[model samples]
Target: MLAATASQTIGPYWHLIEDDTWADLTRFGAEGETVVLTGTVYDGAGSLVTDAAIEIWQTSPAASDIFPAFGRCRTDSNGAFRFTTLKPGPVAGLGNAQQAPHIAISIFARGLLNALITRLYFQDEPLNETDPVLSMIEDEARRRTLIATRTASGAWNLDIRLQGDNETVFMEI
Candidate 1:
């Protein structure tokens, strides 16, 4: 019997098979408070990770013809990614607790055996204070890593750091 080859991580050529349109969740004209979420992905050395793939899942409001509630984007040459979508409302969590309005993030990059999971919470959301997930984080500074700041242009910005002192807080499932 022939031996099986070792499994390998996704290569840099992922973009070749992914359509750029998948990055915009509002491409079909979803209705709600639309905002542009933009950010860059960095590696352990703080260098741009140009080949990373980011997927966001919004859990709120029933899916409609316009809002599919999910989107995927690949980082550009500058390691930046952007998503156009509506603001998500609070979703129910364990034990009837409500989670803050946030987007679930999954990151796939080179050197990672498994995709990293995180979340993007809007800084201006009052519900963030009582969010089940955010409240569980004991370190205030680390909790801030998951919050996205609103830009002057009304867009939301949040960078994802894979490592280093400012590394993002990735969640385990």
Candidate 2:
């Protein structure tokens, strides 16, 4: 009989299995409104998690042969990650409700039992007011955690906090 081996967590060495091209969703000549999303990951102690891996999934505005609808990026020494992709449109939610345009995010890091799930929404999008998920978050401050701010250079910025006074709102699934 074969004995079961111990399960291992995905650690800082994820880059070993990561493809460099996975960081850019527009690599195959996808045409649309392209934007850059940038952010940093912080741990419970407020220190940077320099080796976390972040994955984002979003439906494109239109059918495209180039857009893969998913991308992955590894945090740098400063815990920063960036992705270049097209802006997504609002999607249908449960019971005929519409969800705001957003990107679904999954974060993998050292010391984590499982990947953290979250969503990133654009700050200036008016549709955010009626988004089913956003509306469900009663705490205004906590809801803000899911919104990404537009930078002066036209990039969207979002910071993820594992824990603290400003901990980000992570989804259960």
Candidate 3:
């Protein structure tokens, strides 16, 4: 008789997402409004988590050879990561509803037993007002944590806090 092996933590592999090219989803020449998504990761104590891995997926342009709609990035010493991807558009929600334009993101870090999943909603996007998912959160402050605000350079910035004060809203898988 055999039993399943003990589960192990996902990774600390530097080779996986180290390639700078992997951080650029637009490398395939994806068309549309291309923008850089940037952010920093912080630990529960509000210290920088310099060794986190981030992955983002969008549904707007759809996945394809020219537009994979996905990207992976490894945080730098400053706990910052950047990805070049097409700005996603609104997507359909569960049955007869519309969701605001958002990018699904996951983070893999040393302390996490599993990747933390969250969605990045655009700040000031009109659709956010009526999106079913956004409407579910009545607390404006907590809900704001998921929003990506545009920076002066026109890039989207959304910081992630693993815990403590301004913890990011990670969703259950």
Candidate 4:
């Protein structure tokens, strides 16, 4: 009989099997203002994280007949990941407050047991000023970590830091 590995951890190897096509949310024929979201993952030492899996889910376009509203991508050698999807609009938050147009993100990496959660709010999004969740963050600088900026190429980018001077603010959920 073959002996199972003493201690096996699932992560870095799992993303390799995921369909790269999932990186493009529009693959299901979603319609709307399509935008490219790209970013790099950084570890505590400010070094790039090459083996990480990232997934995003949005509700603006709604997960309907065509739009799954979810996508997953893996970091490359440069620690970069990208996704193409429709821009989301403001959605209802808990109670009567409204949430800013944002994408919920979950990240799985080599050193983590449970995935870290966060959100990506677009730069220049007026709704961000009044976002209920964002309002809860008292530090403007810390809150900035949740915002993604538009690059010269017109794509939005927001780097995630796993721990450092300006680490990304991971949500408890």
Candidate 5:
């Protein structure tokens, strides 16, 4: 066996803070729809990015909810992250249009001081057919890049590509 080497001290804020409020507040039931948000965080070079913070938020299906509706999680060694969230309802879109049910995702990494915003819709969501935002993208394959799919176990799995081929489209505002 190899012996451990002496290590140098790190920064003062190296410890993590505990917050149990990360649990999904959405109620899950027989008629209620649920999605497993799973994805791999990556760098611009297409390498797996570990230990990056990924935060996602969406308006409640109830629609009467208040602001600051979001959830967050960190990626593991495999650059995989997952979250259990309720399906969002249609929200007001640009001008007189409306958008489909989608979850607003933001990525925070070493180089990013502010999070990069993106949205994830479902492949089978009927609202996608009428979504104004999705309608702007003429390419079906390009639009599908932002959509996630459900697994055999009833969880939604979304593989996020930071850069290069098949990358998830990031948006401003």
Candidate 6:
């Protein structure tokens, strides 16, 4: 029999139980590099979910060699995970729709055995206005959940709420 809360294990892609795939995220950081993607995951009660894990992937500027994928990191005591990666470039979208240059996000928490799929769009990207997914969301407040704002240093920070105010845009896939 499966664990009572087995369904909350998140997606297999998170692979938190496994250690082979874990990488030195700071390895990619350069001296004085202030670029960091920081965010916190919370449960339905608005409590921090320290046990959760988050993985993010994106194609580099040229959208080339998107294979083998990017990186994965687990949340710390504050339900936060940070990754040091170059800002991704825009990628083609479905049909005639074009997507903004954003990072594809997958989240897994204690109550979710499967990873919730989503994308994080940069706030500075003008393409966000015409992006297909953003356009699909008619609610301005709901659409804002998917956009990540940049800090004074040009690095970005996006806070994710699993089940509270400003919840991230989780895709069915």
lDDT of each residue in 1-173, candidate 3, tens digit only: 99967645556674563777888988978778888899999998888988888999989878998988888898889999999988888899889999999999989877777789999999889999998877878889889989999995558999998898878888985
Q: Give the TM-scores of the predictions, in the order they appear.
A: 0.92, 0.92, 0.92, 0.92, 0.76, 0.77
- The list of candidate 2 runs beyond 4 A from truth reads 1-8, 62-64
RMSD of each: 3.5, 3.3, 2.6, 5.0, 9.9, 5.4
Q: Per-residue lDDT of 1-173 in model 4, one digit per residue for the tens?
A: 99955533346789657999999988978778989999999999999999988999999979987888999999999999999999999999988989999999999878887788999999998999999889989999999999999995558999999998889999986
> Could you tell me which 10 consecutive residues in candidate 6 have the lowest summed lDDT?
23-32
**Candidate 4 — what's its lDDT?**
0.90
Minimal lDDT window, size 10, model 3: 8-17
| Collision count of model 4 | 0
Model 5 Cα lDDT, one tens digit per residue, 17-89: 4233453534323125665678887776888877566778787555234323567777778999877666677
Instruction: Give Cα distance to truth, residue 131, candidate 2, Å.
Output: 0.6
Where does candidate 5 clash, by residue pair?
36-156
Q: Give me the displacement of residue 71 in model 3, in angstroms.
A: 0.4
lDDT of 2 by residue, 28-103 (tens): 8887788899999999898999988899998646446788888999999999999999989888788888888999
- Best by the lDDT measure: 4
* Candidate 3 lDDT (Cα, 0 to 1): 0.87
Residue 27 deviation, candidate 5, in Å?
A: 8.5
Superposed on all Cα atoms, model 3 deviates from the true structure by an RMSD in Å of: 2.6
**lDDT for each residue of candidate 6 in 1-173, tens digit (9 for 90 to 100):** 75655445664345536453432333433232325677777777888878766777766443233233366778778887777666666688878777888888887666685778888888868898888888989999988888877765756778787876777778985
Model 1 stretches astray by more than 4 angstroms: 1-8
Off by over 4 Å in 6: 1-34, 62-68
**Measured by TM-score, how close is model 6 to the native structure?**
0.77
What is the TM-score (0 to 1) of candidate 4? 0.92
